[model samples]
Target: MIKVKRVYDAPESDDGVRILIDRLWPRGVKKDLVDIWMKDIAPSDELRKWFNHEPEKWEEFKHKYMEELRSNPKVKVLIEVIRRSENVTFLYATKSPYNNAVVLKEYIESLLTK
Candidate 1:
């Protein structure tokens, strides 16, 4: 199974292997805190800038981000690894609890789960 977690959340063995999906490391966070660092799966710099997390642009962001994810073969393999694992957690550092990781989590679940 796959789970999504935030950087500020408590890390426990039950949460599974944690992978940080941001293109850049979250500011002020320690390297040792995250388990697998998967920058390859993150949205490209151009797509990330285009989304910008503006409320008015969220729908478009979702669409574009999904497209970005779909086109990347490397990301597909990452998703496959997570699916093959007994459990894995996608850890991100966005302050808004419903931002990048949330969307990506939903997308991943849809693809990897029934």
Candidate 2:
């Protein structure tokens, strides 16, 4: 199963593989908490800045972010991790529930279905 979680949230036993999906290290989070830090899987700086977590831009952001994921070689690594684990939690620092990790989880699910 795939899950999306706040990087600051307490680690849970069911969080099989914790992957930090943000381009930047979240403030106050220890590196040890995450099993993998997939910086390349995060949205490009240009896209991130443009979206700015605006609710109105969410649909566009998901479309553009998924485009980036399709071209990213790092996606193979993420898929491999997911396949090898019972559960994977995508961690992000964003306060919004509709952040990059949520989009990434959705994108990854679609790829896995195919």
Candidate 3:
């Protein structure tokens, strides 16, 4: 199973194999709280800066982000981890709940189903 969560939210016991999919560390969050930090799997700096979490650009951002994920070697590593784990939770620092994590979760699920 795959789940999405905000990095600012308190960690839950059931949040298995928590993976922080952000290029930068979330301010005020401690390192010990996160299980894994996959910066490579996150969107590139240029794409992230361009999107800026704007709802109007969400569709384009998802398209661009998906392209990034497809080309990134770390995505295969993430997929292997997901395949080995029973549950996986992708954590992001963005205030927008509909941001990259949402897209990534859907993308990963698509790969899993195939």
TM-scores of the candidates are 0.85, 0.98, 0.96
Candidate 2 residue spans exceeding 4 A from truth: none
Write out the backbone clash pairs for model 1. Answer: none
> lDDT per residue, candidate 2, 61-97, as tens digits?
9999999999999999999999999999999998997
lDDT (tens digit, per residue) of candidate 3 on 10-109:
8887889999999999999999889999988888899999999888998999999998888888888999999999888999998886688999998989
Best by lDDT: 2
Best by TM-score: 2
Model 1 compared with the native: what TM-score? Answer: 0.85
Better of 2 and 3 by TM-score: 2
Better TM-score candidate (1, 3): 3
- How much lDDT does candidate 1 score? 0.78
Point out where model 1 deviates above 4 Å: none
lDDT of each: 0.78, 0.95, 0.90
Could you arrange the candidates by lDDT from highest to lowest?
2, 3, 1
